[model samples]
Target chain A: MNPIRKVLRAGFELIERPFDRLFGPALNPVAQLGALGFFFFWIVAVSGIYLFIFFDTGIERAYQSVEYISRDQWFHAGVMRSFHRYASDLMVVMVLVHLLREFAYDHYRGVRWFSWFTGLPIIWLLYVSGITGYWLVWDKLAQFVALVSSELLDWLPIFGEPIARNFIATGTLTSRFFSLMVFMHVAVPLFLLFIMWVHILRISRPKVNPPRMLALMSLAALLAVSIWKPALSQGPADLARVPNGIGLDWFYLPLYPLTELWGNGSVWAFLTAFSLMIALMPWLPPLRRARAAEVDLEHCNGCARCAEDCPYEAIKMVRRTDDLPFPTEAEVNPSLCVSCGICVGSCPSSTPFRRTEELKTGIDLPEYSLRQLRERVMDVASGLSGPGRVLVLACEHGGAAGRIGDTVVMPCVAMAPPSLIDFILSRDLADGVVVAGCAESACYNRLGVQWTEQRFAAERDPYLRARVPRERIATVWASALAASKAEAEIVEFAARVAAMPPKRLRSPLPVSSTVPTPKALQTERGTT
Target chain B: MKALRWIGQFVVIAALFAGVAALSDWPRYSQIPKDAGVVMLSFVHGADRKGECRRLTPEEIAKLPPNMRRVQDCPRGRRAVYVELDVDGRSAYRADLPPTGIAGDGPSRVYQRFVLPAGRHDVAVRMRDSARADGFDHESRKSVELMPDQMLVIDYRPENGSFIFR
Candidate 1:
């Protein structure tokens, strides 16, 4: 091989032998989140279908159907309603977490700009989906959703059509609006998934699955939730009355707090500006510079691995006409590079390809796994039986799990779907589910904590208009370097959940509603 | 004036009769209820060659060369799947699942249920494939609102070789 070819070949070889040491990379945090998110979606989809079977789309019947499903079919229909609502909340969270992890890790700045740009719209899409669900319930919250949505649209000047008054109109029940929401709920995601394939195509080694335990746990939890809580709605959408403290889904409704702080228009301005800035984020200075990639011609191979491996598409293949002997080679687009080392990690070909300086470059080892490792710690604390198992789910940073006060640890918290969280809580399966993760940026696989907390938050989604306050899900974060902090956080969360009154082990409702145990309902389920 | 009114209605009635004869065997004499509820369904599984559902458009049919109104599902003599409406909810609408279940049972054969209050109703049906969609049969089924607890069905059984509504 020529000198330049030899050099390029060597650069590629360093990636092939990534450090395999540690408790074995059972899961990559990013992959774990994706796997968990997929299961969460199915949870939503299945429960949504169940709710659909009984959903009445009219003024009088819509609320009645929801009531029948929640109050009568509490085990099946009720659980599905809650699961669907909760799972949706979780899915949005996972997506956001994935975005944040990628962003903090500098994965959003480089050639992957296209992927980032395309994905930004998905945030809006998720919001629309959640709002649509609210409307589908046709409850007080839904009425608020419907009114706000229409008021927003009414500001637009597109009503000049001569025959736009057959059914759905601004002042009345519009078949048009319902049709639009239905179309958006399903279609937007389909479009997003299509774009996602394109985004991943630019990168090699895209993970589409989570760990086995994570996947199963998510599915089990979703099923358990759908069965236990079964999502239902509140009363019919009473547009005339605004219910105080109508339970709100805080994940997507984080914007609600903003709305509360700054009334509508200013918030809209904030959002518009924020969105536009994000869409144009790659243009931000200094962020437009390389975070950690440099092309060494001596170590580089012309395989275009960097180009293919970059999640953000930061590298491009260019001709090696200047100084270099090879006719073709690849160059890093410094401005767009996320320096994720995926390209560096995926490379390994024969020397006949060429040679380059082999930096003893090692893959930051993968420590992601999802065993109830925390359960073992719980046993040590004697917390499992004494108070009931406080399930502290901590992230597997590089290889080992972290324990706080002798409790749980795992990979990304997203891996545990709310169903699992609820299952452990409702069945008294575990005393609590304490999720410890790396700070969003430090997560090696990206999006570990985001998913974990999101799924935890999903438990509280008020789909049936029943606000199930999130059960025993908490987050504590630190860098992989700080194992002690990781331990401290998990223990604190478990202690908190375990200390609560045993009667508070009530199935996922807020600590307030003074209604006696739906003993008849609970008995029916136990019998089943 | 009386004679003129009589002549005008007679002419109008004659025109309607001629137009009805020219198009469909059954002509709608009255408009169905405006509030009639229905579920829009793609009952035929993989009915669209793409295995995706599509809304029909007018230009789609305009491209057809008149001779091909009905397209065959396969070259073999197997009876091709065709859309059949189930007016009764699932209890009255029986779809043969066989060993393969809902997936093997095409969407055209599977009947979904739709319930509406007592009033007039106008339902539509159409066929779609990967590349194009067949012209829709708009206002194809019209029914007077059934009294409470009443039932109705629009059957298209090729084996029986006829379309019937009750």
Candidate 2:
């Protein structure tokens, strides 16, 4: 990570930690707020379809029909109307939260800029769809909206006459005008959905909706609100008279008040300038792209483990070119890879026991390959002399773990294979190993913390064997704000390991099973 | 126990929803009074006569396509109307109404509403068409009695050559 982003991330962590502790990880997965936005959009769509059936599109009947739905069909259609309005409002909230969260995480920089750029348009489309929906009701509030919107449109040079003329008199408004409003209300939402789909196009296995339990709770809350306070339309539009005032839904119509203060042209300028600034944020400071991962076909076993574990879907298993023993080999697509290197941990061939000419793995990052990792681990282990000499493996994004005196920092803790821990133990290089990473719900790489935990527990591939003492290992999930807690965890683990009897090593695993030394490989080949 | 905990979480969420619903203060129709008078002002202006084209010259006609040549090909620009209204000698409303369509060729229409006290009052209205800017092309001043909840309309009639109040 760049120095500026590192400082920015630390600042964000300082603010986020207290809130995380208050809300608990499961209840406050702020990282997944974008998925929650999608869930709310689905609710809005379903309820909107229900409301559409009862809507009248005639100029005279539009307001009357909405009133009938709210008053006469109070039980069903009325509740649906409330749901439609509230869910759409909530979608805006979720999108804003998601945008801020990404900015804080520095996820909008470099290769990730595509998602951020596409997201800006979604905000505009959502607002357009929402405003058109208000117009469809044709109430006094709708009349206000039409007047201001027309004034704003008239600010542009393209129109010959002021659009405000359409609503100047009751005789001028026609059913055809109402039809155009209905068409836009429906069309803009469809466009919004399409933009949302494109927003996730680069991500592999994108999580479009939040966890089912969370989704259920959110939906239930919305339903309760819908029943408790049904949505109602304002009095029928009276273009012949000026409206004194109208209730405003602050969530969607926050800028409407600005029109009165700033005038329509200035308000339009403010909104457009704000949107352009947000869209261009990625290039404001500029960031260097991380190196992509490389695949070693000779070592690949066609297990497709890397493909399965990749959060970005940058890796694929294809037919082997040479006469390798495996029929398929792993391949990395350079463009899509963020160089997270979690695939290195997923590959069984990444074991450090090998003594070949060069340490190699099936899939490895160019800057931080398995060979470099092995050397760093051995160097840290060899330097430890005193009792309770512990090696703490930490993720770069997981706090100030790398700043600790005796620690090996991986791009992500998940990028460190389980065998690496066993290798350290067998060599007696460290008295204990402590693994710390990002908070489980807030992994910057999405699945890093979970996959690391799973690998250690033997629930996923490249699992730690039973022989490795679980007692000597401790995993602490920490955010960047919890540096002190992580350090305390490491100290506590060292004490616990010092109390136990020295781990008696069973016979070392056979050479081939472990990472082979070059001489060992040569001798084995000669024997064969 | 897990299910019970889940239920408890949902109850908390429901309480939150109730709080927000209470605080929203959404408006309702029943709040508006039934007895309200509305004064409607609506009119379409006469066609503009200020910028009509002159008869084509021989040289101008000769430059046209063979099939398009004619004695005259005139262009008519729609009138721009200015309207002003006064209630009891206090200026209540004023606007410059442009032609309706994108090309400024459609009917010039104005629809506006003014809510006034339900009582007798003096009303004056004036309008200027495109052909003359020095004075109003039409004007009306009248004394009228308005009943409670009455709807008064002011319209323009080309055939009658006057403003009609109903």
Range of the 10 consecutive residues with the lowest summed lDDT in candidate 1 chain A: A15-24
Q: At residue A347, what lDDT does model 1 achieve?
A: 37
> DockQ winner among the candidates?
2
Best by lDDT: 2
What CA root-mean-square deviation does each model show from the true structure? 29.3, 6.1
lDDT tens readout by residue for model 2, A7-76: 7667667645654654455565355688888988998999989988999898878988898889999888
| A310-388 per-residue lDDT for model 1 (tens digits) | 4545567888745656666666665454444444433332111111232221111122111122223323334345663
Worst-scoring 10-residue span by lDDT in model 2 chain A: A513-522
lDDT over C-alpha atoms for residue A383 of model 1 = 39
| Model 2 regions more than 4 Å off | A1-29, A507-528, B1-4, B15-52, B57-63, B73-166
